[model samples]
Target: MKRNIVILASAITALCSCNDGASDKAPVADSSEVKTAPENNKYTSQPLVTHIYTADPSAHVFNGRIYIYPSHDTATGTPENDNGDHFNMMDYHILSMDSVGGKITDHGVALNIKDIPWAGRQLWAPDAAFANDTYYLYFPVKDKKDVFHIGVATSKTPEGPFTAEKEPIKGSYSIDPCVFKDDNGSFYMYFGGIWGGQLQKWNNNKYDSAGKLHQPDELAVLPRVAKLSADMKSFAEPVKEIKILDSTGHLYKEKNNDQRFFEAAWMHKYNGKYYFSYSTGDTHNIVYAIGDSPYGPFTYKGLLLAPVEGWTNHHSIIEKDGKWYLFYHDVQLSGKTHLRNVKVAPLVYNADGSIQTVHSQK
Candidate 1:
């Protein structure tokens, strides 16, 4: 999804040294010193750390601790446009903690854009999976021809100096790769985003600079799903489009911006059901749908999160110590869209298994 270009002078926070998974002394800032975001509402959630800017957090529990994989935001002075030119992020830093709001460790740079041979620029959102005793990091980046491709990297530990493969995954395009592993030991990836994400340009399964756009009366662009091979490197089958239906079980039309998919696809299971959540980009909301199978014609449930103090919202949900937490990012630290900070808050589920609406604050 496209982000707004709002830049401001950054306020530095006090730095502290901590033990990282890589055994490197990574710098982290005192969370108390970070400024509250410019919002009218009070917030209980704060940035996990403020020493550096991070966004699009994909957090997972590994070895009884939480590991976060987020895009390392940097102010490259590039102007913003609908094409997402200003988000000049070139690397990834892994964050881990024993508990939420506890001492968090910055794992240093896990992967860099320069290290990937086929990558061009803008290493956007990424996700991690642990399978076959190996940690796999899945990410999306534009190649030399400026088309987006999803890639995978390998590491022995959750916090990593990952080694990238020589090329992107075959038959993969678009951005925001969320790899979800099932209880049966199968892995599935849910991804796709419009606008700068370039999903609209791939209507024919290939990129066309002058692609046709869906008419307002047509069903909106659908998020894609594919099963990961046993090796967890390539797709096991052809990528298929996912259908999102309204509460009445009807497909969402293109004009339904507030309900249609934009970007940041995430899947988490609870009580034998698959919950597919994503951002409604321009409307600034995180919504979800529920289905019996991971490959779903899911029926829309409702809003998981309302609008925050930023133009975009991306998130991940995980259960820790019998409690659920939502990890997300906002422009609270730098007051800029591209320079974002990660935050976590408790997520609640009603007795009926429906998620309670979350409203983020400053």
Candidate 2:
């Protein structure tokens, strides 16, 4: 049976403050000083749709329309909520926006778990890109033990029943897959997560997984990058692990606290500068760094957004319209489980090109 599930974003004013240290002042910018742009180009707090339960949102302007591909969680499956519990959700769903102010029409599951042989019922973190009349969905899947690995699938239509490649894109355990097509038309895949293996300890390359000294393990939780072949079917070269952020020292020193390093990497090229935003501190907040190139010597740009106490902010970034809009997920107040509902707000930038702050709607 063909089903069209149109999930909508509802209006809820759950105010969450952006942390700027001990300041009690609100994070809102003065609207009087803010210059307005054209009606079609202006930023607003209104969401086109609501009531969604997807996370790790990756959007693109394709064929005069906006299409969003996110990790698909089966509404009727086990671990039916989004509280980090691993279950079989090996599908990519698509939402299409016809116009700037148009409603988001959920086109049902674009891909499904039955499509991938090695996938063990769980899917998470998906990103999509269009090339050569095909839309590519890059996502992560887990085996029975919940060990994750990255995979790719392709379809001719934006709203698709994508077909997974016969094999994974060449890596062991990993998740949160992101695909970047460079200006020169080169394709690259960035992904990593808590893969079980003897990899290097977080933050530094000193210790191994077993607390022994050795070279970095290819199956570490830390982020890694690899180039794809021209056809995007296989890895063109070897997987090169890149340490996004490590908290080995912090984790070792503060043994009582659960230390999280970097995961969930999304790369965007803006104004000749490459911005890499990633999740940190238990996927509760986001931090970013910029570099001159995609493969880089990156410099930390500080925190872009933080957790809202009652909510978590995972993989997100600004959608560059006339005014930038930050797209992220938050746990709705009404739900007990963390079903990562999508939310957006204006992203203001400082004179130095760093994100000044992201404001939430009241």
**Strongest candidate by lDDT:** 1
Overlapping backbone residue pairs in candidate 1 total: 0
RMSD (CA, Å), candidate 1 to true, equals 6.8
Q: Highest TM-score among the candidates is held by which one?
A: 1
lDDT of 1 by residue, 23-116 (tens): 2244444222334344222443557766778899999999999999998888887899988988878989998988765578788889999999
Off by over 4 Å in 1: 1-41
Q: Candidate 2: where are CA atoms >4 Å away? A: 1-52, 74-83, 86-90, 99-101, 144-146, 195-221, 243-260, 309-312, 318-321, 359-362
**Ten-residue segment with the worst summed lDDT in candidate 1?**
4-13
Give the TM-scores of the predictions, in the order they appear: 0.89, 0.72
- Per-residue error for 201 in candidate 2, Å, reads 9.6
In Å, residue 158's CA in model 2 sits off its true spot by: 1.8
Q: What TM-score, to 2 decimals, does candidate 2 have?
A: 0.72
